[model samples]
Target chain A: MSESVNQQPVPLHEHGQRRPMKKRLWWIAISPSVWAIHFLACYITAAVWCEKIGEGNLRPLQISVGIYTAIALPVIIWVGYSSYRNFRRGDPPVPYDFDDPTDRTHFFGFTAFLLSSLSVVATLFTVLVFVLVGSCD
Target chain B: MNFVPSQSALDHAGVGAESIAGLFWVMLIGGCLIWLIVVGLAVYAIVVPGQHDQKRTRMLVIGGGAVFPTIVLTALLTYGLAMLPDLQRPAPEGSQVIEVAGVRWWWRIHYRMPDGNRVETANEIHLPVNEPVEFKLKSEDVIHAFWVPSLGGKVDMMPGRENRLKLHPTRVGVYRGVCAEYCGEAHTQMAFDVIVESREDYDEWLRQQASLAVAISDEAEAGRKIFAGSGCGACHSIRGTSADGVVGPDLTHFGSRRSIGASVLPNNADNLTRWIAETHRVKSGVEMPAFETLAEDELRALVRYLGELK
Candidate 1:
């Protein structure tokens, strides 16, 4: 049964469309990359503000961090939503344990969904630091 | 080993330390509970009668591994981060400001008196109970950290930059403070006594610290002469007799301090004598040189003279 499923490969769209390996991997990696970039942006902004700009008013830092978080969160949510759609596309739904292109696509989609969820939480945590700590001190 | 109560953060005597101790308890209990839950889940999976359906297994893997940890850690992070602003809050305006500079293996302390004069002291710090004091911390050479665990959190003292830490000590007792940063050789020996007393007692102590040293007895007077002549004044300052050298710790009220050699040894005649004769043996890499060339009688007179400063 598994061999038949593997051999009958015309790229099943009912489950998921088979894309190039690089594109699939990029889809898996994009959410975390966004999170990493957001983390760097927030921290570097804070460091430069604290060092170059005097520790007087934190309004600018707060505004900049807020903007970065606002931008990053929506992107993460969109990625998470798209991945969830891909994960739920198959007739069998999740537990994509079959040895076929459709199952492989679902597996990658599930992995991407998990990564996006993790990145969303991590980005929120990064923003939480600025919310609690008002000053460089 | 002899127990030091002030060395432990759990034995909190100040407002800041109280919050820290509370946080520690919460974290510890939370961690234990999480560990038990995780272990119990594993045990349940093994001890169950039959294989769980795919849905249940997926829930066990995803919910237990990811969701559970995410929720627990997020809550913990929020709880921990909320404590930072209060911990970093500056003292109120016109409050008592104490300037402390971390030197090699010692602490140079200055109490900013209301009369615009700074009362310089070393090693020991006296604070009035029930009052918040702001410490303007600096490092004269390398990086160091001032930590009085019983009182509050530690603050780093970096060279060329001043960091401030505010502590409101509630208990009136003797506490120990140490350099939390590993500065150099003898960093372990860099410690001081924090004497929290009543307002009256604190004022009296400060008054005495501000006054010039007086050699009342003949032995003390002889030692004073020896201290001045032996070039000890070049690094140490005793306000009365012109032994003013800013390189080392101020010795105006050296005898009144609870410990000698930055708390490396107890403040006693034997320890003092030994410290003077073999400075490096007590704490290596200290800037002060040994006075091994002094005669036995001269060393005793110097020790006696310094002991009477209190």
Candidate 2:
């Protein structure tokens, strides 16, 4: 079995870059990352505040959520706007051609834009949660 | 006669448990709808005969994948958040408070009387129906969790700090409670029974728990002598008698309880006999050693004595 496997020609896909280098793809991740960090900060703040100040007091948890929302919303909005601008700049001459540089770039930008939009909506939903829920039991 | 215990989240006997049940149904229905739609769309895309248009495909992906989940999740999140305060509502003005400390394999229970005296018991807790009862939980050893599936959710018992859970029983019945966290040996055998009764009945039971044991038979007296002579008093206690060991469960009213051996077995003659002879077979990690060296009649006498203390 080992001899036969070695003799077989390696698949062409194994020879080159598995995934293309697209630095701008990181843009799509910004909104979701903001949402995650904000969630962690909010949760830790609630737990520690409750432990220190007592579960009866809700002011600390409420204030922490307020601050988390205020800081997270603007950053996610900026990332979403940037992705939208890149997506709208132009379209490839012949769309859906991965071998063509311009087409690949266009595809990456559009995907980033789409993901950013979804993430922004998710971030907003999370902010609403922080605002609406106000207890630590 | 052994079967898996039914632990369903929908069976709510307390207000905390009721709110949890309501949340569960909402999530269940919503999740099923989402599952069906996603699967249906995928199936339709594969089976339907139609021209594939890029614009239509993009629109479908954006609408179904992004918009639908966002709307549904946002609504669920808001609803869940709105119920938080209700779930943690403060206990009623005169709610009774009880403290339960988790040990290696049992629960040390304490009821705070109005006269500032705390009545201590073990393994079993009795609560009055329709009354809010607050449980102040702690741990004497490693981390353990207190869970009565039919009554409410589980709460962790941390070693150094205190946590509180409030339960208001809506029904009169016996609920099985078990240690949800794995502390050490015999964790699976660390079970307790919560008896919910009417206020009058619960008060009478409480009064009985505060009193000493009553011995009325020669067999019991003979067994008591054996228990004292055999050094059982070093780790066991029968309040109102000479045996006052604090290392194990209090057996002052053990016979009257619904179950014995920390809910591992029903409190009956045969099971009690087997427990004294072969305790390891019944619960492997239990700290008690077998009394197989004792003669058959002596063991029977001891079992009868322990069985009739209630």
Candidate 3:
């Protein structure tokens, strides 16, 4: 069993054509980065609207945060789907327990998929606030 | 443990407080249920004699850790956020409006009467049960929060901006209110009594508060003379008297209050004397000066006079 696991081919990335470590890490981090940007945009929009426009109208805030959620969710879902595909690439899918190059790539894919899933939920939760709170008060 | 219950948010007496307490119970019970399931799974995995496959283990971890928490937390968020609109809804037109200014270490309350006149009171608040009252909260100096935990949620009293809170007391009982936000050295001492009474009783109390302070006895009459002679009128106001100062609490109905010195002491002759003679010792950093220079007889007379203002 150990010999067969060691003999598995590196199917995703070719030997010399592999991407740099930094670029690969960026792919892992992009999901949470999108979440962070969405979070800040929602907060700044609410703060400015409350401070400058005063209370009684939440239409603008709801529309702006809705737009941000729409933009963030699709990107996160795509990233998560791609990561899931990468994570399941091996002949005997997941538990990615081996110490080979292919297994390491699979582990990274698993981590990115988990992060993307979390970001999608978090972005939804942020949008939930705008929907529930009707005014600055 | 002491038998008497301390101040708690769960001791809900009003509509808003009831909703808050409900949310707290739901969250607490939901969290405990989730904790039990997660811990039960871990205990079973550790103690059970079985060879669990990686696929089953992965499913257990993902289902227990991520999916469960996300669903539970999102449900809780939705339930909690749904309460905000009703809690923040403004009182209807022609509601009884009370303007409460958070002064240094005290509360300055003004009731807008039906005929457009304002009646001023301090340290204590009275409300009619089952009637929604609009409180226009403000701060004279630093930031303060008006929190009657049993009545409603706390709202910050900013210096320039006015924040509003609506409270409809369901029970007729005395509840304690405190400055939830720390402001100064005597922050902890800033407390007041919230008396929820019948509509007729509330109206009667407000009527008495709007009236003038009359000196009924010779001792009270003599004490009034001393209060005027000693310049106590500079920062204090006793309506229908020469003391028209707006710098301190109105003393027109001081004797009728539940507690003296912002609920620091029980309203009585001895506590009033101590508070008047050694104001700083009773509550440090208070803006009121201690009347240490007054003679013993004069102080007694002054206490007599203030005690009779009811």
For candidate 3, lDDT tens digit of each residue in B138-187? 99999999999989999999999899999988988888899999999999
In angstroms, how far off is A80's CA in candidate 1?
3.2
Interface RMSD of 3: 1.0
CA lDDT, every prediction? Answer: 0.87, 0.77, 0.86
lDDT of 2 by residue, A20-133 (tens): 323355666777788888878877887788678777768767777778888888887776665555444444454545543334445666666666676667667665665776
State the local distance difference test value for candidate 1: 0.87
TM-scores for the candidates? 0.89, 0.86, 0.88
Cα lDDT tens digits, model 2, B188-241, are: 888898888899999999998877887648887788888888888888888888
| Interface RMSD for each predicted structure | 1.0, 1.9, 1.0
| DockQ (0 to 1) for model 2 | 0.50
Which residues of candidate 1, in runs, are more than 4 Å off?
A: A1-10, A13-27, A48-57, A84-110, B1-5
Instruction: Classify candidate 2 by CAPRI docking class.
Output: medium
> What's chain A's TM-score in each predicted model?
0.82, 0.68, 0.80
Clashes by residue pair, model 2: none
Error of 1 at A127 (Å): 1.6
Kindly provide the TM-score obtained by chain B of candidate 1 when compared with the true chain B. Answer: 0.96
